[model samples]
Target: MFARRALLGLAAALALSTAAPAQTQAQTQAQAQAPNPRVRIETAEGPIVLELYADKAPKTVANYLKYVDRGLFDGASFYRASKPPGYAPNDYGVIQGGLQNDPKKVLPPVAHEPTTQTGIKHVSGVISMGRHAPGTAQADWFIVIGDQDYLDADPKDPKKTPGFAAFGKVVEGMDVAQTILGKPVDPKAGTGAMKGEMLVKPVRIVRVRRVQ
Candidate 1:
């Protein structure tokens, strides 16, 4: 009877040990699948709240958060609004902001997280990184004005062009986003890729912060 009792006790101990790890794994998976982080970007027009897809674009989200934490976007301006005439063929485009390659405000580039990999699309109100080339994105980002699936990675030939990294979307203040999109652009101000796209009076970014 003593031996049988000891065996039962040992079996119970083993069962507990096994259950502990399974419980921990279940908790970890639940945390991983939790709701993504949210942030509020206060601009002169209004406050645009964005919900970032940390699970899909972890690195991109982290990089953006770093800038927000450091107050890098304060006083920044939405300097470009790429619209119909400014960016022909692509009727609906984006409102570009952040450092704008200022060198003074630019942070080091983060690794590109292509839409093909993240499974995020560049739909209206979607926020995406702006880069001269893959792996060159730093502080610059854009908010899509309308359905812009062309910004997504071409599944047929993703190797040639990975497309932009879309990390989040405007949860509120899209009307403000459209207001910025309709702002006046300088006909003779910008050069090269930015020609005719530069805003004559860029909208100011008052501040950006994380919110519950």
Candidate 2:
């Protein structure tokens, strides 16, 4: 009957409409959830490789990747290395490095992801993105020179504003980081995070790439 044919045609049209939308949604999710691209930092001191964790902090890791894939850290020096003021050797330590004078490369601040939600910790050899303000963290990242678990989650927080979210850690060449740490920072040189003539010969990051 013509009525039956009409109903069948309507059903087919409805199915076509619904299926297309579902397929589009699946494609979008796939693009979003793909494994984070790997990044490696090669310093004149040595090469430090890191695997970014995009799943936990997609916005954060994605932000870092934007810098890495764009060659932002290359030719830049590890401008600041801070050891808790007066820590004999390597006590309270965390070394941060990134683009210094290069204005061509820089990213806008992303949301702050603390350890409480991401479950990421500031363990030794762990590399974390550094932010100027609470949510201003971006391309600049630091490597934990000591056990910095205090930077992790705070259970008391409901919003989980615990602290800086750690995305990845160093897999090799920590000695290079140590060497930079031992390079004698001046308090008045206005360089190497100091006030007057520091670094003598600044430690630089020559290149960065993705490793298997």
* Alpha carbon lDDT of each predicted model: 0.90, 0.74
Residue 31 accuracy (lDDT) in model 1: 99
Candidate 1 achieves a global lDDT of: 0.90
Candidate 1 Cα outliers beyond 4 Å, as residue runs? 1-19, 86-91
TM-score of each: 0.86, 0.74
Clashing residue pairs in all predictions, respectively, total 0, 9
> How does model 2 score by TM-score?
0.74
lDDT tens digits, residues 36-141, model 1?
9999999999999999999899999999999999999999989998887545433467999998778887778999999889999999999999998899999989
Which 10 consecutive residues of model 2 have the lowest summed lDDT?
191-200
Top TM-score model: 1
